[model samples]
Target: MLRGVCTALAAVSATGALMACRSPHEPAPLTVRVDAGSVRGIAKGEARQFLGIPYAQPPTGALRWTLPREPRPWSGVKDVGKPGKDCAQGSPGPKNPSSEDCLYVNVTAPREHHGSLPVMVWLHGGGFTQGSGKDYDAVRLATEGKAVVVTVNYRLGMFGYLGLPGLAGSGDFGFADQIAALRWARRNASAFGGDPRNVTVFGQSAGAMSTCALLTSPAARGLFDKAVISSGSCGLRWPAGGLFPGAPADRPYVPVAQGQDDGLAAAEELDCTGAGALACLRGKTTAELLPHSPSFADHLAYGTRLLPRDPAVALRAGAFAHVPVLIGGTRDEARSFVAGAIQYDPELITARTYPRLLKEAFGRHAGRVAARYPLSRFPSAGLAWATVLTDASWACSTLAGARDLAARTTVYSYEFADEDAPNVNGLHVPDVPQGAAHATDLPYLFDLGGRDLLVNRERKGLARTMVGYWSAFARTGDPNHRGAPRWRPGTAPLSLAPGAIRTVDAAAEHDCGFWATTAR
Candidate 1:
């Protein structure tokens, strides 16, 4: 059952005059009737927020690892004043608790908007193992952009993506959940003062990968009018000897056979092997499953009805939804990942060990990689390593995907180059500058981390510009609007820096020419 606090008030009258009195009360509920039921949200400033609204029945017991089921209709008003518990995963913090029954979506809309505004649905990123939609506050997007915003919560790790044989639609339940949320939005957006037909799906990192997957999935066609992908691409793959060390360098999706192999291993570890393995696995408690959850390296299985082929392969073959796309990555995308490693082991990286590490990461191409990214050129071997992976794994790969997508529809690319962007909560490394790292662009788009981080005039201006571009794109297919810099479609990407937005030849900037010849 849902948990929250409510206060009762008493009315006093004298001489036919009445006044209501209470000591610090909750905001009056703002009720809206949706297809499933009536829900009461809370009003805060210019935005009305409906939090913890379930889009599907809880995926627990027999339903675990299966496609999401539609939530049952409710007879009375459902209280959605508080955020829902995040899907069961690694700890986000002490305050953000998680549960197996998490499949909620939060809506934030302008309190005094007129009829039929555009809708922007958000998907959070945590390598498909962590993060919740509640991590982002859409009030700034709803109030400033004048559009309705919806943030979704999907299953994570073992409960969400484990692929065992005989389980229908295994390893892709998380993707199914996202599609369900989009379907829900199409049916009920009008009740939240949003246009059902006009919707945009946007996300960063793993969330961005999910967006890319949806673009390629036949099941997700017609769900969204436009798409935005940040710091991720369908073509992104980390080679065995590359940035992620021992992990395989193939594309993100695993085949069904590999998924079943993983499932068998997990079952053996849990002592649930044999004919009744599926039943025994499902009967395990949350605590029993938490320690055995798969890492980020575990991937959603492809070649199913939902995704007939790999996302990159499907995109290149023109087998994806023909929708306008905004795709790009950060200028220094690998710094955050590399810096974290350096912090863990101070002696982990050094100038003398640079060439050896490169050989271990790049194999025969290590010599070429070492020549291009010499340790003498960078402040530390760690920075040099990050630069190589940033160009090869992120920038060049995303550009290749964008070129393929451009052939079918309008595709606009960008690179976040905020060299001095404020350090956000996660991805923090002591004494190392983040330099527009993986998720640094998040604060500019949403009031994430904290408002104080954006108090500076320059940061505030950039945030407004980003919001304008995002909302404008949701309204129309294009991100260009009046007052903002004109964004044009081309191979060159628009550089998003503090107080600056201009097109740059990102291929040349990141040395994609060298990577194209050497790396995958």
Candidate 2:
């Protein structure tokens, strides 16, 4: 059973009345007949929204650990008035309950246009542990960008990612769920007046990691033409995290004594080993084990066909899908993660500790990496740490992915630098201002019907520009527009994280310099 959240319906103006009516007994709203069922959605001011449409069969009992099954045919039109319950995971803040039956999608489209429009499919980030497609609404993005926007809910946590011995495979099942959702879009997007052929997959944080995985996996090769990864990097499979296969005692970072077991080990601890592991886990109740769910970074399973090796290795070997990509990171990308590491104050980030941690993770390259981004050049210890981490984790990873892809594909790179990007959530450290922190770019790309505490009017204008660029990219592989500045692919090392808006040639003016400066 799915849990319910807040629900309300607002009226539309006379000029837009036709877009909001759903039936003759009521009004004529946006009506679309999907393959599994039909939906009637109302126009919410600028955009028409259809919410809570299931894309796959509910994974219950015997269906657990198995691949997603096709959604069952419904007898009548489904009421898609409210967004579905998020995947079965704890919310970051005060929100809703978690459940196992959350494989649904929500779509928003422009009102005036009728033919097949470009579509942007969103995959929410929670490190494959938390977050929901419903948490984000696509009103602003669809209306302003004039493209159909789709947000999806995929499996998460142990239910979604656990790779037991008896399970089907030893990789990311959460990612598999997303691929299934995209398949759903390819099959039924035309009903919503969207062009299935022109699809773009995008996400932030853990969602970005998922995007990177999709780019390399053969299963997701033809699903999307373009991708946008924000604030997450690939490579570095720590033994402690359990994504890779190396002896726990062989790695210094492994804290096996801390009870941080990998999915395999966790299953063993639960007395579930070998082929019957799926059945063993299914017998347990949701309440009996959730209080002790694994951390977001804990890798449920890997070393499978879906992910033959780490994504960074795949990107370097040129084994990924050859698709045009837009990759970027915020100025203060790691502040959120830093904030979560309490007791480790900004002042505590010394030259000794910084290099020590880096050495442990990077080994021989630690000194070289540290030299490129020394703490001595920054304003404060926190700022220096944030800069290096943002660059190393997000900026550099994106640059590497873009540069490698550019050898055979088109790749544009960026670094968002808006400092006062309203972070009223108090999630980041006070010293580490949002400064285009992790996910600040999302609101500008899509209008979810409410003001994100981190945005205002000036920011809203920036949002329009950003959405315009994204929409153009969805329409055509290129992100160029009539009035906007020309976007060039990052082909060289110096141009990886170029200033905010550097022109492909002279005759144009953009803010590429601002991005490059903060990035450095």
Q: Which pairs clash inside model 1? A: 238-249, 239-249, 241-361
lDDT of each: 0.81, 0.64
Q: How many clashes show up per model?
A: 3, 14
What tens-digit string does per-residue lDDT give for candidate 1 at 1-520? 1111112211221100111121213322278777788898998788899999999999999887779999989988889999889899874457756899999999998777455679899999888878888888899988888898999998888877787788788778898999999999988787777888899999998889999999999899999999999988998877653545444565567887787788788878899988988899989988788776755243777878787788888989998999999999899888887777777666656677677667766789988988898878887777787888788888898999899999999998899899888767355555446898889889888877325367678888888898888898888978887798889986579999886799998999889889888844
Consecutive 10-residue window with the lowest summed lDDT within model 2: 244-253
Which residues of candidate 2, in runs, are more than 4 Å off? 1-29, 91-95, 233-261, 273-276, 295-303, 343-376, 452-455, 491-500, 503-520
- Residue 132 lDDT in candidate 2: 89
For candidate 2, lDDT tens digit of each residue in 183-211? Answer: 88887766666788889998887777778
TM-scores across all candidates? Answer: 0.92, 0.80
Specify the highest-TM-score model's number.
1
